[model samples]
Target: MAEKIPAGGTDHPGRGDWPVIPDEREADLIGLDLLDHADGPDLVLFLAGNQFMAVPELLEAFRAAHPKVRRIFCETLPPRLELRQILSGGAWFRGRLVTVVPDCWATVSEAGVAALAEAGRTERGQCRAYLRNRVVCLVRAGNPKGVAEVADLARADVVVSQPSPVHEDIAEHILAMYRAAGGEALAARIMEEKREAGTTLLTTVHHRETPERLLAGTADAGPVWATEAAHAAALGLPLEAVEFGEGLDQRGRVRYFLCPVRGGAHPENGRAFMDFVRSPEGRAIYAKYGFLPV
Candidate 1:
């Protein structure tokens, strides 16, 4: 007898009883066509975000569950940019099945959630939350620099590298926290020094690339999600994390969400994948990656 396929299997076109949206616009927008076309051993799932490493165990489990799904197309862009691509419909080529992980603290605000809901209204499908992640700062191993606290970051000898505050929402939050902690004078002094000495003390890069630079010692410190930092440490990289003395704000800890592009071809599959992510097994994967379940 042939191997028994799972009940919700995607191996056969119609075996899983997957909801098939007839309208091509909805199907195409959600990436149903790509799923149909790439029905063999190489199904492509495009994921864009900053915390890729935080969920290795979860990914391994996902692979174990769905062996046919191969080739995860990923981009390490900042969440803000990812949001822009979704809003502008820039990912039409990658099939309508675009899955975006927005910065948990930055993009899941009341206004942000409202905006996403509006966007979904225009599209045929919808958006939903997948997981939550904690943002933390990564420092050199052993913190030999004595940069033990966020306030120490304002010291002259310290070089802080972060993503652009304007486009990188998490960076903006850190900046806000710094200002709240009375780092404004320090920021002004840094600006003055830059104007007088033409020295750039602060550096910001796209979110995905921040970790690589931190591991390479290109920067003394950078902001990163807790799980990403954990993964880096697991890799034996010379990195350590400094959680805020007061801890993350109550609301900040529960902000990450996964949004499915509207009018895409793979709403049903998208929903299924999301369901798997929310399942007990999926939660375990997320926890292993340092993300809290939603």
Candidate 2:
């Protein structure tokens, strides 16, 4: 196993080894964590992993619009970990302590913005919903596992790569979807009983693990953002997305927010990026990834 990254590592010794991203297959196990120019950027950001597909295009366009801000470092970690990294001051990634301060923080809920504001570390900026997404079941082609709907996820034969509620906000929404489909019993069966039976594989980074596990045939299906499944499918992965109706999928619950970090090194860059995200062109980038723009 690769060295585990410690959580809530706010106070580290100092800056040292920058993240050494593993190869593609190896990284599928750890979720691609780093994005953009990480080595000394004029602006840094902590973004939710689900919307990761839109970052490269968004950043590239933002840079083109404003060439002054050349370097931009963005970390697409889970929202909770991203919050902890900002609150704790740094992260002990692998064995190295990374201490880069963030200029912006984005998450699935406003609670992330509130948390930073409470810490007095949040900057005054456009803190509002910029994107939205809903749940879907990612399954193999031809529907071999027979997972046709959300309720099928609770079947005894199915093994699900469920995201950890403790680490990811999406888990609660997924749990709600399960409850809507099969009541509390279904939620318990998949989240508790199946997990005990070694059927529910908890994933810290479902964006990477869900498709990886499904394609590897280790898991029959997983609940993921529609955007995630679409992004993976676009990459030529042999997978199909099972759409959940509004009654089952938590349609209006998932909203994404971007909060500027107070006292960041580059204030203008953060503001510029946020402005661009709300622009029509920015919305197009997110829309390209199957995300609903706010």
lDDT of each: 0.51, 0.76
Query: What stretches of model 2 exceed 4 Å from their correct place?
Result: 1-39, 123-126
Candidate 1 stretches with Cα past 4 Å from truth are: 1-48, 54-60, 63-76, 91-112, 120-127, 183-205, 248-254
Model 2 lDDT tens row, 191-280: 999999989999854456888899899999998998888887789888988888988888888788888887678878888888888899
lDDT of 1: 0.51
Q: Each prediction's Cα RMSD?
A: 11.6, 5.3
Taking all chains together, the TM-score of candidate 2 against the true structure is 0.85
Residue-pair clashes per prediction, in order, are 17, 1
